[model samples]
Target: MAVYTQVSAEALAAFLSRYDVGDLVSAKGIAEGVENSNYLVDTTRDRFILTLYEKRVAAGDLPFFMALLDHLAGKGLPVPPAVKDRDDREIQQLEGRPACLIRFLPGVSLSQPTPAQALAAGCALGGVHAAVADFEPTRANSMGIAQWRPLLERCGRDMDAIRTGLFDRVAAALDAVERDWPRDLPVGAIHADLFPDNVLMLGDEVTGLIDFYFACTDIRAYDVAVMHTSWTFNARGLNPSAGVGAALLDGYDRSFGLSAAERAALPVLARGACIRFLLSRAWDWLNTPADALVMRKDPLAYLARLDWYVANERAFA
Candidate 1:
């Protein structure tokens, strides 16, 4: 959803020639996200999204990512399907980076969601979990609990620079999460990063659920925990409300009931979610160039969220 790598018109035209998608009309960088270099591509025949997989994405994992999209889309989720080229390939090399094209989906992402929208997001996530029930492929959660500490360690002394005494607090939280992280919740393929920007809406109606790049096998409830942490926070990161959390859980449970264990572990999982994002944002904040095509996110935003979750673990219940 961002453009770290630049693509020229001639290069794009050469790349488009390999596909039967038609002649390229225009290509524009999309600067919304912090991950890959993305562009909205318009061709004579259709509009598609071109994503240049950056180093953050492992090349070995591309097959799993693409196949999962095909599975979810085939199962009738609102996800965009990856476009295949004339060779029937979902991936190709462009500018020496792994890239792929996906059919452009309608609807826009919402910054702040209503309770009804929260309900729809919950239902959509639940539906994704159900749809992938029979999908044969499995990829481990690359950003799962085990990786958080290492991410923090990589952040190292740089974290203290972000906020005095911030490293210790985050380290303490990471340790606590590692100690109490759940083990036996129902396991399935999950859309691990379901932030509001990843969900698309047409007014109050849920129209699309994009970005399956973070999909992996993990506790289904942990996915719900991501939703709780992401969707329940208000603007300015001051007010973390339970009403949205309640509505989301209510909607999800209507489709897939949560186990006693899942419910009990939700608070800890919410803490883990906060830790995951905080570490990632902090890492990006420290490493990514200020003027990079990608907008570096503020780690303090998630730092505030981590603190909020620590104080209001019961709110996620």
Candidate 2:
């Protein structure tokens, strides 16, 4: 969540009048994520999240996100669905950007998760894949492999500005991943970006899975790969935990069994995941507005992850 667009108090009050959520008690902009503009909104009745779609979030994709959340919530998953207004509209214009009021879920996002938490998160992710098996709506992975090269090209030589020789390393990794990318893996709707922050946890139990903005139809194992990269490593992309990684895989296997092909392709899938984040972070590092309320993540973190994945592919395989 980020705050690129500032919503005025009068404008916010007028917008809330359309809903039955009650008078606004307080609203604060969230400045953690690099995606949409988010506000922690509290009304007389309850707390909620106000998200304004920005950056890579397309307006046409809002319905897909809302429907996916609704479907997950209906399946007993702890996903926050978009709250509809008095006119039953979930998507509306706020500050000239497509916005939605999300039901506030109670939990804290873990920065340094333990093995047990990783297990629960993995199980929850597997359950999501299972629940979405019959979800008919299809939205392509906008940040998929096909878009990586162009994103990197957009970053261009500036990649090395973050770190010496970063550009070439990423480019070589991208080439290898694209050339040897897997085919015919199990495909389904996936959260796509299951970083630890996206998961809301109470102790070891996953109370909520927030931020489905990057959710899409993609290789099921790719989601696992994304989680593997995100959950098993420290924020600096150092100090990988074998215990956490093992627990995560075990939990997912128990919840939703992985086929042999999926298991065999994990190493490559993991490298692809690394490349995806590396390029996106590189782009964001160079281009994100100087005055944006969001923190500019270091692209080198993913580069470090990419290096680790390349060296440790055999272990994953």
Candidate 3:
């Protein structure tokens, strides 16, 4: 959720004219994520989210994302429902960009999640996997292992500017992960990105899982690994000291049992998760425009996570 594309009141009003969501009262740009242009739209009827798909997100993949949300919402998952227009189209064009209005989910995202939140997030993630088990749309993870090497090459020696030997460390981690990447694990629709900010909570209950933009078909345990790295670790992305790593995994196991292979591959999957974010943050740190509405996250945070994962692989057991 960012504001790469600015929406004028008149333009937004004209856009909303196509929908029965009522006249737009106010719309404000949300400045959290780096992918799409998001605006909180309030109307006489109800509140909603308006997202203008940015270049980072492929236009062709929009249907899969919209349909996935529709499917999950139908299953009673706490996710936003994709609001369709009068023509019954889930997506529309605004300012020459593909856009959609999603029902505004209730609750706020946690910055530093509590152990209880972690436990609930674990259960919620398992439910997400189960809910989407039969979803037929398949979108390959654009940020998965296959893209790591190319992402590294694009970063090239500039990563050394962030820290000495940073490029080599990331390259080696990529090599190790790709070489030993799991081949035969439970695969299905995984959220792929379950960061703290993506999970919304009101009190102890997780009200919604927003941002299905990174959702894809992949190893289910890899989703657990992503959640563990994001939720259990400290803000600095080091020291999985929340003591919720095991508890989170335990929570997931109660819903969908983790296989021996998934357990054994946890370490590498986690390391790959670290690399995925590190490279992304590094690239955004260097390339994202200074005036962009999105925040530039520190690449070093994921670097710390990578180090911790390497040293504490045994702890995941």
Candidate 2 regions exceeding 4 Å error are none
Which pairs, if any, clash in model 2? 1-33
1-317 per-residue lDDT for model 2 (tens digits):
89999999899999999999899899999999899999999889999999999958999999999999999999999999999999999999999999999999988998888999988988998899889988999999999999999998888888888888888888888899999899899899999999999999888899999999989999999999999999988888988999899889888998998888998999999999999998888888888998899987777788778789888877564
Per-residue error for 108 in candidate 1, Å, reads 0.8
Candidate 1 has its poorest 10 consecutive residues by lDDT at 234-243
The lowest-lDDT stretch of 10 consecutive residues in candidate 2 is 308-317
> At residue 310, what lDDT does model 1 achieve?
83
Best candidate (score: TM-score): 2
True-vs-predicted CA distance for residue 82, candidate 2, Å: 0.1
In the order shown, what is each candidate's alpha-carbon RMSD? 1.2, 0.8, 1.1
Predicted candidate 3: what Cα RMSD to the true structure? 1.1
TM-scores of all predicted structures: 0.97, 0.99, 0.97
lDDT of 2 at 20: 94
Q: Candidate 1, which segments miss by more than 4 Å at Cα?
A: none
C-alpha lDDT (0 to 100) for residue 258 of candidate 2? 84
**Model 3, TM vs. native:** 0.97
